[model samples]
Target: MSDEKKLPLRTAFAVSVSKTAAALSRATGRGDGSVIGGRLGMMIDPDLLAHLAAGREIALVSGTNGKTTTTRFTAAALGVLGDVATNSFGANMPTGHTSALARAGATRYAVLEVDEHYLAQVIQATEPRVVALLNLSRDQLDRAKEVAMMADLWRQALAAHPKVHIVANADDPMVVYAAGAHPADEVTWFSAGQRWQDDSHVCPACGGHIQRGEAGGWACANGDLRRPSPQWTLLDGEVVAPDGVPHEVKLQLPGTVNLGNAATALAVAAKFGVNPIDAIPRLGSVASVAGRYAQVERDGRLVRLLLAKNPASWLEAFEMADVAPTLLAINARDPDGLDTSWLYDVDFSPLRGRQVLVSGDRAMDLAVRLEINGVPFTHVKTFADAVAAVPQGRLEVIANYTAFQDIRAELDRVL
Candidate 1:
């Protein structure tokens, strides 16, 4: 890793080219240009991330779900201390990391939402001050590493970086195993409330079934794994601190899931010396994070955009779709992961009695799932067509990765 102050001529040239590419991408309406630019930059300079992140304090946020929202919240919370550099658009790869740091100029603090697989490399390069480990679950099994494999990777990575402080979720057994390498005092555990425990039923240590007990406690049948005492717990939508003081957390985002996200972010913020009382208000200010819960008016229809890439995320999104006339979209693009089979894991039975309109390149796939679940659905060929189908009232538009972005982009043009 070369000093960023005196970056080599090639690395500097790569940065310039990457920035120009990103600008051109945005101008042409291709995309946000964050991923492409970062991709191009990393190609030229293999160590571009290390170079740009030199001499900066970093807080790496990683997990199966809620990484993007948590990253946004943590970055905003850290703003109380100083300007923070972050990959705001949910790009959690090396290229994205390079692009963010390259554009950040002289920012001292970086809060990055890192992919579970890339945690080791990013941590080695940036040497983050704190690492926030959210819940781990099976996501994109066809493309992503298995839950146990990812846990092992995290355990090995965190074991090597023992100096880094850890903010981990105590309720998740996988997260507990991953952060177990760190000493008790070095880790700050938070019970964020896990609703989807199907993937985490087995203990990562002895392969024994994890048993859940009262008060959000869990222990393995083999006595190898158990939940740790959490410093922060989300109790009935309120965030309780280590002192047994509960703070009411209000967020512009909907669902108990966002409340959990806020809890984890608040835990990280407190470790950075941000007052929870002050940060709670700041967390609420985040109405929508990259179109997660954004409402847009298009053609006289109020459409709320929600993103659910994996089954766990879908479970959360489905819980929030209590409104009528919903638009469900699914895509299997690179960003969304090529495997659409995870759709079957989501219980779409809740949408059984509603008027469900489906759209996306994989609309038929979702249509089939809805039909099997006994939910009547119509497959619209395009997002616009689906939006047009919802004649009036609030239309709940829930989509997977790329579909969410496409719908959000289309609505942004009209709204």
Candidate 2:
């Protein structure tokens, strides 16, 4: 109400109308309405997002993978200061950001998940206090920009906003090159171990081979490009702060990838003046992120959901998955990237010893890839069939974007 008084009359009306539209969208069972509402609000007032973000203590989380989960972590850590508004869902675009800020109305702190490609646009609008650069990899090749291009965009954005502190992953060469655009004092580097080397083998600064060290450091074979020594590091479930104080990472999300995410969150929280030791418990409280690692009961069997959008995320998901009956779902829909060719880049060997079932709109494509990889799998027609095809005690489901949403909806209906 106090903030509304500061808004121009037309912008205030646009906010009200967008809220009504969002509520109607929810009533009609369309979706969460975050995107639609924000779209409408921006249509009325083109600068609605910038206006809403003007005075907030904002921190943005962006990357090819783990944006949603990392944003959740940052919000929870910042919750130590006050009520932190965030996009809990996977909506990371301008429209989603607009809706979130509009709904949260006057929250002092806001942590927003930003899509990798839209990082520059969001940085300009939010002018956040801190920006967390997670990692870069080949994701949605048909739709999104290449990793190098994204890194370049980030570099330009950071160069323009020298005042904003950058919390960067030092293990990722792409991240290092991009965040290196800022002055060293303004950037806080954290090494959490980058699992996917498929995208970062080449030096972003020069056309050279990036030689990765056995200890997780790297250097350019042709030039001076190399991994920066991190102020924060996540090594074997322990997060070491800049002062060399190590805090044990106790996370419910499962796997080292989530631990890496926790490290990034802690660094961002530290920039916001929250003690890293105090934020550990808040990070542990995040059990599931937008249905990524949720375990649901189906016919007395626990079904765990793990979302993997690209090869990089799939590798992490495989590590988090248990040695149980695993269901792999792939969709070539727009949201899931119409090209299913990225499946070739992923090594599905982890599921070789377990009973595997494949299902989705692109089940045939997935089956062919599995066949080529010598990974045995059964092709099922529907989610129910996939569930019944394997002996049910504990089942792990991995799906990309839209397919993941579909499975979650089906689980809601069935159980």
Q: In model 1, where do residues sit more than 4 Å from their true spots?
A: 1-13, 413-415
Q: Write candidate 1's Cα lDDT for 151-269 as tens digits.
A: 99999999998899999999899999999979888899998788788888888899999999998889999999999989888777799988899999888888888888888998898
- Model 2, residue pairs in steric clash: none
User: How much is the lDDT of residue 276 in candidate 1?
Assistant: 88
lDDT of 2 at 386: 79
lDDT of 1: 0.87
**Each prediction's TM-score versus the true structure:** 0.94, 0.96
lDDT of each: 0.87, 0.89
User: Alpha carbon lDDT of residue 194, candidate 1?
Assistant: 85
Residue lDDT tens for model 2, 1-415: 4566556886888788778888888889898889999999999888899988988999999988888999999999999999888988768999999998888888999999999888999999999999999999999888789899999999998899999999999989999999987988999998888889989889989879999877997999987688888998876679888999989988889888888888899999999899987888999988888888998988767899999999999999999998999999999888888898998999998888889899999999999999998899999888898777777588999999889989999988221
Error of 1 at 232 (Å): 0.8
